[model samples]
Target: MTGDFTARVTALLMPHLILAPIALPMLTAGLMLLLREERQRTKVAMNVVSTFLGLVVAVLLLVQAKQPGVQTSLGVYLPGNWPAPFGIVLALDRLSAMMLVLASTVALATVLFSAARWHKAGVHFHPLFQFQLMGLSGAFLTADLFNLFVFFEIMLAASYGLLLHGSGRPRVAAGLHYIAINLAASSLFLIGVSMLYGITGTLNMADLARGIAGIDPSDRGLLHAGAGILAVAFLIKAAVWPLNFWLVPAYSAATAPVGALFALMTKVGVYSILRLWTLMFSSGAGDSAQFGSQWIVGAGLVTMCFGALGMLGSQRLGHLAGYAAILSSGTLLAALGFGQNLLTAGLLYYLLGSTLAVSAMFLLTDLIERWRNDGASLAPHEQTDDAPFLAADLVHTQGLNLDEKEEVLIGQVIPAAVAFLGLAFLACTLVIAGLPPLPGFVGKFAMIHALLNPLGLGSSGGFVLGSGGWALLALMVGTGLLALIALTRAGIRHFWASHDRAAPKLLVLEGLPIALLLTGCALLAWQAGAVMRYTQATADALHAPGTYVQAVMSARPVPNSPGTAPGANGRPQ
Candidate 1:
């Protein structure tokens, strides 16, 4: 028994071993802002540092992969010797590490992409960008809910400045909406936190988990209500349906690098949902143990349908991508809510692949626009000699005479590249739609299998909504088909149409970032199995909350930070 306990503790602490590796770039970036004398030197320094950060995170993830359990919880630093559950605690289980790696890679790529142009306009872009990275890394690593909120606010505040970097009317307007919506969500987040503290008398997640395990019968309703309210904050962040109006405008208005960074924002919301559901509301080992996750699945189904529809209808390329991301988020939520281990695993892979692909697309869009603006095209605009070729006008041209090589290259090479990225995203959508051959199909299949079981949802906690599963399946298929059709049509129009006028040549600086992203996406396709294994392991960890509580409760207390004593309700006791 003692050996088993020690093994669990070791498993929980393993993930944090690489924290310093990840934090190096963030600290360097911050320090450079004050010390670096020249803008050119500072930008160069930031790029190298950010790239190093990515490499470190990649290494950490690789190390974590070699380990079996993939769990780690860091008690407060014990700075000056403090006690834990009271000190600032940092934790990195499978989910946190997965998210950290994703965020790190995306940030590094964007920073690399922006290296040449970030400081072009005499702004302190490097420092702000570095701070943003810090905020993101901290948000993923922190275990405390309040600290998570603080980190989120830090990121958002940095994002607001970054979004309005160029000082345009559209960007300024979008920033307002972004700020307003997020502020509202933040308010609700605090309110939910207050309610939880008042009732449970503890804020530590592990403590809250133990507390939730033994809730009073009469207070369960109140606890559920608080949970529901807290969920609303995350939903708003996730850009889930009915609360997703802010996503399109905000994403479209931000620059490509900014947009790419924003791609990780939704995962933050999903992370909270996963943590809360797994730790606080997990089903127990009894005939009566049903946590009512079907509601989450139902929400996921609707979100998937609505998101796909929105993506199809969007006119602008940026807005289309925005809608597509929302659709993807919906699918992710639905998959997790589906309450099948396979589906959760699928969701994990889909998020990783989709973020890489969409982020690349966002960055690529900027490059395309820049190339068109830089006069790399064979045919310059007849009327506006100086301005970039109008994207809409390019589509309006009827036909053009081109050499065979040009035809092959334009029709084949460029489209193939774009198509490759599109397919990566399409794979993600297909998975969301629960299609076969992809993880999504596997996940959906598993979910259906679970639901069909006699003792599963159909048992005591079951709500008999006739044909609900079939209806959801039909919606998934229909929307999946529409999204594919829409994407294919757009691809044909953008890539195949014979405008005869070359828009621009690709720049190494502008194009390489996306190329890196495409490579990662392809790798995701290749390594789907390993990715799914990680996801399944993560889901298993989530389902079993005892391991998490035990690790935190038994860890050495940090000096000056007192343990949260259990309340009268047996919560945290």
Candidate 2:
């Protein structure tokens, strides 16, 4: 215990390690902005650096996973080393590490896919992407509410630019709504933080988690209200249900790769909900049943229903995919809302599967868009060309129109790539739909098992069931069926239909990203045990808030400070 304390305190006081993840990209972005030579090379360099950084971050996250509850901070300059109540702190733990890894992986894939377009457009793409990453990583790591706001702004501001990167009528219009809604959500987030700070007298998440209980009951209402408001802020970011009106248009209108990247934006909000609910509001302090758990479930189910219906209703392929992404998010949030330790474990794994699957699909859509028969340039704002080619054009579209020689040529060039992508997405869909032999299936099975378990269903306690559980079960089955129907329908149309016309072959640049994502899904299917264990541990930790409070409130001896002596349970003497 003493050693752990010393290490925690020591980690806090130490200089930042490498700072490679944030620094290298920011530096590259700077260089990209200034140096105009070899645009393609510059873009390639960006993708390479981002990929390298992701690998490095994954390693660091793995190292951190070895010590889940311990607090660590790398950047000292952000909050000037102030502890707890007075200044900013960026705290990393098991959940944040998981999110960081997922975000980095997705970001790296998106950047790689976008490489082909960046060179042609001559945009300062690299720096914006780097900054976007910086904001996302910082959001997960930061422990201070105000600083969370800061990073949120940084991320959204960067996203605003990305959404409008190569702007046009549709993108500009969609970006307006996206920006307006998020800006409003951001403002609400700040307001909620201020109210919580006023009541609890602290802005640090750990400190607030520790202090939240002692506040007056009325003041606790304010805290719950604050938490609820914050939940809305995140839900807006997550695009949960009615509040999610901005998502489809925003996603469909933005660059395909950019939309793929933003698919993660919703997860960030979900991550925050998981982090804060577990860390701060698990006890009777916040009417968690009403605010923390039930509401999320309700919103999630609504989101799922809405998204599935939207997908069924939409004719546009990109919009259909966007709705599907939203539905997957609802499943995640609803699982979290169930508030069962097992369900949370399920939520974690489901998150991984959905993120990888959605990301791969978005990139694939971008490639498909490029292959439109009109020979029309895909504008920055358009999902893709809407014109339909003759059924006979499929052969020509395969670049096989001229001769057997041309057919061989085209097949050798990019048809293999397209075939690989289609199969990958189909695999992902199976996972997403909770079919067997995939991690998504495992995750859903675990969640359903938890829901049906005797203890949770009140077998011993006389038919007692949590409000969120039934709704969640309904959502799980309901959404799964809807997704199955919708995706299968779309799949048959695109891959199996007998048509003479084929869209042009997509650029080969996206091959790596698609491969990376599909490989991740396969690995997750193979090695879900470790992830499920971590998720279980995380859920258990959240259920037992005492473990967290004890860890954060306890103090370590400062080398020369008189007040640093060990006290009860190593808390300040």
Candidate 3:
């Protein structure tokens, strides 16, 4: 009886388990909508439970993804028992599973952080939060371009609410700009998707991969055009230079928790790029292999340089974090442009570590600024008759002072709170600067090592350190130095420059989540070997598009009735 019960439980959950990541938050959001507005605590409890369950489900999926028997993307779920390329499908692979895990972790952290105050700042906060998670999870797990678009809209709509939560004039203005740019990008998304369908007759990514190689020579130009247009939309969303002006302003204006969540948003665009490029333009695609590679590298290099410089000039910590996000995106794009499996492996690890650190930076920025708002700033603001050390705002003119307020007071609760903030800020600095003994340093070191010694890591062949590799290596080191100098200077100003320093009251909810995210970085460092192995395996799978195509296109629909579907189909739905 116990064995029977265990078997029954496994049968019920295992088949549909992949859907849980996407479905749980969606159901939670709907349930939250049903609750009356007065039961705020109940709503909070529901949100937390749902998010925690989603994270648990994501981890389980990751474990299954690593299981044997599949070339890639372990679990493929077709809604309503429809076949692939004909119906909505959600699939999981090492890469997608990793992303799902990352998104869920960020969701849990931000939600926990919000519980302190941000959630209660506006109505419908709980529902919107769940909706955002639903969208993010769906985006990561989706198997087709159409569903990807749908999830993007879902995510953006919720972000529209979250970004403008506790609306003020600053938020309103930034929110409007954010909404307008994304709306335009969404338009481009539709246009590009339509073009791809017109050319290939399918919107399923795996299907496209299989179909693109067999297309007529005459349609090659159109295919590239369609993909280029689509890339423009992604590039805009990813905050590449020349189209990234909205990122810093919009991200900086958001509340702490919302801003922390937004840390993962740009990565979605980067993920989209990675997914499409690998599937459609991998080395196997004959003439189309590595299409537009140079442009991607150029854009990434420009964005990295821009972000590094912008960060140096930033007086506000919020802006610094925003610029750091742009820098991370650029790094991924540039590394990915190389199209080497080992390089891809390193960047994947970098992506995870950098995103966590950047999210922590956003949270810490809010805390430090709050201290300034509470008149506990250690730095002097403006010129005084006796001593005028001159703050950054005074030195760089008023333009650098986006929202830095000048206040001064010494308070009692200084020793402990200030120490915590100081240590957290220092960790953020170390991570951002790619200093030793953190996952950030490990990630960068891995990428550089892979680039310089591809054959040393059991590679099947040799790689040339071309001009591009040299350039990337130089920028990686240079940017780290710049970040260290800028962040260290900001730390000194925030923690020691002024005599009116004090510790402001930090809620347990607020401090705990920040510590949790940083602790994640610590764990990543401690387990770097295992994490790197997983990432390397993921990269190997991604570079082989044929495996992805075979897996996705061969997936069949689950039969509901004898006549509805065939039972002997490939990759049981």
TM-score of every candidate relative to the true structure: 0.80, 0.83, 0.91
Off by over 4 Å in 3: 71-74, 376-414, 454-463, 562-572
Q: How well is each residue in 380-449 modelled by candidate 3, as lDDT tens digits?
A: 5533653333553454464433224442232224567788889988888888888889888998898898
What are the clashing pairs of model 2? 371-504, 391-500, 391-501, 392-500, 393-500, 393-501, 393-502, 394-500, 394-501, 394-502
Error of 3 at 528 (Å): 0.2
TM-score of 3: 0.91
For 1-573, candidate 1 gives per-residue lDDT tens digits of: 999999999776543454553366566666767664466665666656766656676557555644654333342232212234675556666777787778878877887777757544436666667767777777766667777788888778878888887778898999899999999998888988888877888777877877775777777777777777888889899888888888889888888888888888887888788877767765652321335467666776777777788868865667667876787787677656645554455567777766776677677666544533453334443646534345434433635433533232234345444454445445444443445565545544544554455245323223333465565556656766766666666655554555444445444665667767766666665677677677767766676767766766665642222564432111110
Q: Give the TM-score of candidate 2.
A: 0.83
- The full ranking of all candidates by lDDT, starting with the best, is 3, 2, 1
* Per-model lDDT: 0.65, 0.71, 0.85
Clashing pairs in 3: 378-498
Worst 10 residues of 1 by lDDT: 564-573
> Which residue runs does candidate 1 get wrong by more than 4 Å?
1-18, 35-38, 65-83, 118-122, 285-295, 370-468, 558-573
Q: After best superposition, candidate 1 residue 152: deviation in angstroms?
A: 1.4
